[model samples]
Target chain A: MSLLVELSNVGRDFDGGRIVAVDGVSLAIEDDETVAIVGRSGSGKSTILNLVCGLDRPTRGEVRFEGRAVNGRAAWAALRASRIGIVFQNFFLLQSLSARENIEVALLGNLGGARQRRVRALELLAHFGLAERATLRPAELSGGERQRLAIARALANRPKLLVADEPTGSLDVQTSQSVMSIIGNAHREFGTAVIVVTHDEDVAALCGRRVEISDGRIRSDNRMTAMPTPAPTLRIR
Target chain B: MTELTLPLRGLISRPLRTLLTVLGIALAVAGFVALTGLTAGVQHSFASGINENGADLVVSQRSAFNLVSSAVPKSLSSGLSAVPNVEAVSGILLNITTADDAANIVMAGWPSDSFLWKDMHLLAGRIPAPGDQWSVILGESIARALDKRVGDTVELQFQPYRIVGIASFSSVLNQNSAIVPLEGLQQLLSREDVFTLYEVRLKRPLDKNDIAVARTRLIAAAQGFEVGDTEQFSSSIRIFDLLRAIAQTISLVVMAMASVAVANTLLMAVNERTFEIGVLAALGWSPRRILRLILIEGVIMSAAGGVIGIILGVLTMEMAAKTNFAAGLIVPYLSGWSIAQALIFVFIAGPLGALYPAWRATRLLPADALRRI
Candidate 1:
């Protein structure tokens, strides 16, 4: 598989370099792959995900997307808009927008017109079993439903890579399993690669590869020969 | 679904904040509209009064604070009329007095047979006849305010005079004025043989150069007096200048406060929506788009306030025109130019007020913003 994103010896610092968030990290994500990054709180697993998604800039290393070096805010924003999608732990859906509108917003510059965006948003919502709740605002939705809406919004542009920072961190076990199943379905159906950051071993086990980090540095990396067990049938309700 | 949807939703979600901010801007714009409208009305009335009288030149006391304070000797009328190209000259005495039922009524005095009286189109009754000392002609507006008709008695300065005619003039000032024989007014005011100013009419077909030459001759002949053409005299009224300056100054201060209010509201909104903004950025919305969203919100609020303010100001001025204190004194005139000025101000203020907040929103790092609770 071709590499979709590559990070070389990336370092990030805060407070004028007094705090090191990520250090000496080099990683590559290929097309159609599933990778899980696991670490304790503040171990820089989320920071790595940020670098991979171009949400945060590295202080000392080069980050490349689709073989071009990402150098400016505009370049990163363009890449994120067209090629990368991100899901957050808190399900950061716009509270004011309806579920369908939230999805439509992601398609704004990437899509042709309002009508096309609306039709596509509806299709995504119906695929996620959220068609009936398309008019509901994020505040009116349950935690799982909000997360599903967020995921639908992320995939609205059909991004090549999905970067999720603790996709199931705020959900109950059953809901987490259901969300994992949906993520697996997206990977299989869209041929999209995913990078998930989490502390849960069960969540990490669902990915084809696992990378462990400690003290802002990668400690271990492993690739399993066997395909991750097929996710259980998704129960959207 | 459109570009405005998210920003509009954000504003609608915070109903009270949006309303208060709009009201604040509305009040400022209203003040601008009302004060500027009143001042413009004054200038218009003064110019119309001059232009309507068919006066080519006006002679008044030099450096006088206002037309009411200007005094020129009635004896100068003959000399002014003798100036080359001068066709006729009329001496006028002006005063302000309250009638029994009306306050702030303008009283203007002209000769019974002066050409100035020719401009007054009598709607009813006859003009003050020669030797009629206790007769007055009421402008249509003042007649309406006092509810008096021709031949009815109206009391001015504790003295009752018969309304001899109901007349209409082009200017609002004249329309709301009471016209009397110049000698009768001079006798009443105890200033006989002294007039407020002299209105001069040059021969028809005279160009501006001829008028200028005649004005110079009049100035030279009537030493110690200022002689200007109608346009100059109309524009030189100190009270009109003062009113305009005051209106502009007050409007500036009010607009500044409104801009600050808009900025404060937008800042609060940006602060409250930091997380949502981060989500937008993460979703691939560029900083420019985020900035545009915030600006659109501010502009929407300001534009709304501007429309509301214009309506409020017009209504307020109309109401004030009917009040006892302002009756016959203020004519609310709202020109298209004034409305356009107010709109331009609010439009400029919108982006100006939102600029900082939008910049701050753009500066937020998506990762850091998403980290917020």
Candidate 2:
């Protein structure tokens, strides 16, 4: 697999260097790889995810996507538009848009014409099993449904990398398993790279590789024998 | 999806704020239209009244602010007539007074032999002959307003005059006036041998040079008087200029207030949607796109308001024209130029009011904004 994103000794500081969020963190993500970053609160795992996705600029070191340096706001925005997708813990689906429109919003300007975008958005909704709730707004959906809608929106532009920050932090165990299964399915179906930042150990156990961070530095990087395929259906208690 | 989808949805989500902003802009635009329309109407009526008489030149007192306040000696007519190429000269006196059941009635006094009387079309009955002291001709509008006809006695300033003719003139102001014999009006107003102005007519088949020469000669003949063509004379009315200035100033103030209201509403919307905007930014939307979204919302609200305001203003003027207070006096004149001016103001105000808010929205960082709960 080719290297999709490489962070070279990235360091991010807050409050004018008085507080260091991430220090001397070197990480590399490969195409079609599912990696889990595990850390406690304020342990810089989320910061590393932000730097990888171009959502935040590092105070030191460089980030490269496809062997080209990513600099300036315009460059990062272009990358995020076509190459990277992000899913927040809260889902953050636009309340004013319906389930289909939420996915359509991300496809705008990056996809084909309006009609094509509509068709693609409907297809994504159906793939995520949200076809019946296509017309429903985000607020009207359940927590699991809203998270699925967010995931569908994230993949609308056919991005190469998906950066999810605590994707299932707000859900119960059963719903978290369901959301994780969808993420694994997305990786398998589209061959897209996945970087999930979470503190839940069970969530991290499903990935092919695990990286543990402590005190703003990587403590252990381990690779499992294989990435376990998630169950197709949620199992009750 | 089109670029306008999100902006349109944002406005629809907050219907009450959108509605209030539209209403505010509408009221401002309505005030602008009505005030400017009324002033323009007055100016048009004044110019039409002068043009309808075919007067080549008008002569008024140098110190007078308007024709009605002008006082030139009636003897100037003879000297003005002696000027070379001068075909005819007519002297007139004008007054504003309350009559029975009518307020602010325009009373025009012209001699029976004057050329001014030639343009007054008699709708019914005969024109007053010379030496008819108590005879008067009522304009069609005032006749309809007072419900009077030929041989009906109407009292003006407690003096009774028998209506000898009902006449219609080309201009609305003239149509709303009452014409009387020159000497009788002088006797009634106690200002005999003094006229408001003189209307001069040069011989026909005259070019611009001939008129200029005649005007110079007439100026030489009538000293201490201002002489110009009908257009210049109409534009020189200080009262009309003052009314137009006041109307424009008030309209500008109202437009500024509306712009401020639009700005405030947009600022609040931006604040409330900070997280959503952040999400859009994170979704690969550029800063320019976000700015455009906010500006489009403002412009949509303002455009809708402008259209509704124009309708409301026209209806208000039409209703006022039918009221007793404005009967025969207020003629609402809505010109295409005035409507375009209102629309231009609305369009300019839309973007101007949204500029600061749009800039503020663009300044929000995606990471920081997403952190905002």
The DockQ-derived docking category for candidate 2 is medium
Tens-place lDDT per residue, model 1, A37-86, is 99999999999899888788898898988787888777788888998889
Query: Which clashing pairs does model 2 show?
Result: none
Model 1 CA deviation exceeding 4 Å by range: A14-19, A172-174, A225-237, B50-64, B72-76, B79-87, B118-126, B129-134, B147-171, B187-194, B200-232
At residue A183, give the lDDT of candidate 2: 84
* lDDT per model vs. reference: 0.86, 0.85
Note the residue pairs that clash in candidate 1.
none
Model 2, residue B266: distance off in Å is 0.3
The top-ranked prediction according to DockQ is 1
Give per-residue CA lDDT, model 1, range B1-373, as digits (tens). Answer: 9999988988999999999999998999999999998877666666666677888889888766776777898788778888888888988888888877556787888887789877669999989989987799998988988799998998875678899999988777777888887777888888897888888988989887998899889998899988897657656667778888999999999999999999999999999998888889999999999999999999999999999999988987788777766665677889898899899989999889999999999998888878775
What C-alpha lDDT does candidate 1 achieve relative to the native structure? 0.86
> Which runs of model 2 end up more than 4 angstroms from their true locations?
A8-20, A57-63, A67-72, A172-175, A215-217, A229-237, B54-64, B71-73, B79-87, B100-102, B149-162, B187-194, B200-231, B320-329
